[model samples]
Target: MPGHLIRKPDPCIYSQFLLMQLNQPVTWDNPDVRILSGGVEQYTYDLTADTEYTVEITVHNSSRDKPADGTAVSIRWIEFGAGSQTRHAIADRVANVPIWPGTAIVTVPWRTPATPGHYCIEVELAHPNDGNPTNNLGWNNTQVHAAQSPVDRSIRIFNRYPRDCPPVDEGGGPYLDYRRAIYGWGALGAIGALLYAHVGHEGGMGHSYAVSVLAFYAIAAAAGLVFYRLHNERLRPRAAVARAATGGHADCHRVEVTVDSYEFDDATGKDFHPDTVFAGRTVVWPAHVDPPSFIFQPGEAFRDVTFHTDAPDDPGPPGHFNINVRQGGEPSGGVTLTITRGG
Candidate 1:
């Protein structure tokens, strides 16, 4: 009998099979990107025009077996405004992501534009074999400002869409129509006049009654026209209806406002009190206890919100704070105000 033929599995085929079993899908969603003004602890601070800052992009790998050896990150900045923004490239960086819970933070130096105004930051990641590419892009559009004590800053909340926004419904319907009610009142005035005319009268009483009736109808007509004009104004495009339900027919959309204070160390670029870094800061306007919410009309797309902070006569150490506004739990806009204590 011929010797049994001995065959061995091909090394290349075996390696390919092992790779297929061990490799898993990679996603770019695990990374966290931020724009740091000073150090890492400073979180997100305001950026000054014509100044250099650092952009930190932390790339994380969720796969335990596979590691993302080399990942590309791109940073860009855009002019501060609503609607379509023009993006300008800042810089590109490469980060090495380790396996499992390990993360690689890629920091890039950025020089802000000379034009003095607020700006928006954007960061993007690219990988050769990325499984999911949807979450690779991130945006930092929060505005930052620096002011001295007695801080009086006006924050503009812009509604990009050209349409009216009604107040969020809470049980009962929040919308109202004054046009119909005014019309009803006018009709009633007419009926009252006709009834007086049917009951014929003579001399002074008749003249006086006729005059009163004419006066009443005249006032009603004038009031109707006034209400009509006001109604048309509220219905204009991009206006925000923010009237209280009990006050008027037009109810504006409401937004939540939040303020946070932090004691920052200019030397180290870190917060002095890390434990209470995000504590609420006291403000003169928008009472800390009963902070009033803001409303947007239908046609008014851009609205300015002014906030005041009465810093102590001897305002402790130099610090900074941030004002954030949200609509329906979504961030509409915000500003980081750095306190500049005057000597």
Candidate 2:
């Protein structure tokens, strides 16, 4: 009689479709289609509705699983719309596929829905041993436009803009660039009037014109003053300011930049008042003779604490500075200041 045949142990099957004890799990790397001219892999693809296209996905085995035959991969498509529809089994399976500890590319045919809309593609692996469900899925969004064919008058264009770069000078432009000629003519007219008034008149005859020139000069000066005050009030110079904790304290802290007898200036430092203080954002605190302090709390390092000066004429030196963290005597990490603009 023959001896009993010895039995062999079955090989271990490690599933990579889910997260296992290991950190890395199987993933779908890039899902894309070649529809554009450059053939770049794009998450968003434009598709003509009611048409069929080829979609491809890369399946990566990031686990310590060994390659096995007869492994399956599943693919699906989701349409985003009123009801949010989903199409299952865009590709039912890639049967008898062998995948190792690397990546395998799978291609399938995807037919666009009859109705034009936005859609997404989902690729998944069917490994039974996959424990991490999070990384096992991948998706892509696609834009579907109405089918392109013979033009129909019934179709309406919802958005419109000037596509030509050069304006026709038909009266207006999108911006102020076309007014160069008008500005030049106005400047020449003003210079010609001034020259004619100066050179064309006798001493006695020039009196009235002199008076007119004086009046014009006075008006111009007044306008200049008004604009100067407006500019100073509106545009305050800003400085790059940062504050951080020098000590290794884990607790949060506050920094205060105090101004005496004034408010904070605007960020541009153009405008100054006794009632406002420009902090990280343009803010106006109440005015006080004692000194108004702008306070900011920093939970972490490198907080922007620099503020524009409240100087009346220009951003002169800020008066009565206070940099206290956690209400303690002083902070090891003080503020550093840098001018953001040249005078």
Candidate 3:
């Protein structure tokens, strides 16, 4: 011990922020918030780029120690730039807490970096005496594409019934009613005709019966065709089936997914980051969506552009459905969306 260096006491103050836990699934502040038609929210929504989407995250306090009311929750928004280049926080938000395990929601107002690329939203709790400081911080990654004409062209699949329906007899309802009616008409027509042929009456009585049978058969055929057209080969009545089993309408949980930007040409005027080039730029998706329990993993060669749950039926014409976007290993943040009858 040459010269016995005097060590100075640590001067940095530290407090354990709220610990992130799963009291309930963390999702966007408002995932399905609809911007009204021609309203201010809609106007602002339309004017801003995709990066302008404010990410609101909800965190939970698992620790027994209650976080003081008005404690600050720090949120850091960062962009992962091209190859080893230094990057700094694009924005920061400090959300005040009402109590631990309560008021855990934080809103990062700044638009995602103007640069279209992979971005991360990191949330941390600022509190002292936190037994585990390491757990105070967590992050989630998402890709920001050049804004398109239809800002959010996400595909929605409605299919929560299959998961919620009871195991037994999940089929029967308006769908079944139509199917039964079709079968009844066809069967009655055939039986009536066969009986008339076997036991004929005099003077057109048999013809009259045969004519009635033909009418029934024609109606049945028409009904069948209508059903086929409405419910195409790939479409399944999963929601109806669940409703029948549960004696209530199946929840229409819309799974909204992010649509990818395919190109960065002159047509894409928003693509104006001089430091970065869009050509050959790869997007990094969450390794898993709603992970640990439900995971969607696109292989190494393929970059996952969208995350969605299994749809009950084939992709139908664009329509509104309840949407939930859970980035794997990260809290779900709501994306500003403008819904229309058709997109």
In the range 10-128, model 3's lDDT, one tens digit per residue, is 11111111111332222221221222333233322232435455545554443344443333456555432101113356344444443333434454555544545444345555544
List ranges where model 2 is wrong by over 4 Å.
Answer: 1-43, 81-85, 95-101, 142-343
- Model 3 Cα shift for residue 280 (angstroms): 34
Candidate ranking under lDDT, highest first, comes to 1, 3, 2
Q: What is the C-alpha lDDT of each candidate?
A: 0.51, 0.36, 0.36
> In candidate 2, how many Å is residue 123 off?
1.6
Candidate 3 backbone collisions, by pair? 15-127, 15-128, 16-127, 16-128, 17-125, 27-332, 28-332, 28-334, 254-322, 254-323
Per-residue lDDT of 238 in model 2: 20
TM-score of each: 0.45, 0.30, 0.29
- Residue lDDT tens for model 1, 1-343: 3322322111000011121123211111112456666675333425567877787776666456556666777788765432223579998877777764677778888887887777756677777755444446555544333444456666556654326544443322222334433455566665667675667642323467667566556666667656655656656432333344334324334566666542222121244453343233453333221243655555656666666776555644544444555554444444545455544
lDDT of 1 at 68: 66
Write candidate 2's Cα lDDT for 115-228 as tens digits.
885565656656554433445444443222222121111110110111211222222332332233234433454454476577764243346765645544555445544444
Q: Which candidate is the best by lDDT?
A: 1
RMSD (Cα, Å) of model 2: 33.7
Clashes of each: 16, 20, 10
Q: Per-candidate RMSD vs. true structure?
A: 23.0, 33.7, 25.7
**For model 3, how big is the CA root-mean-square deviation?**
25.7
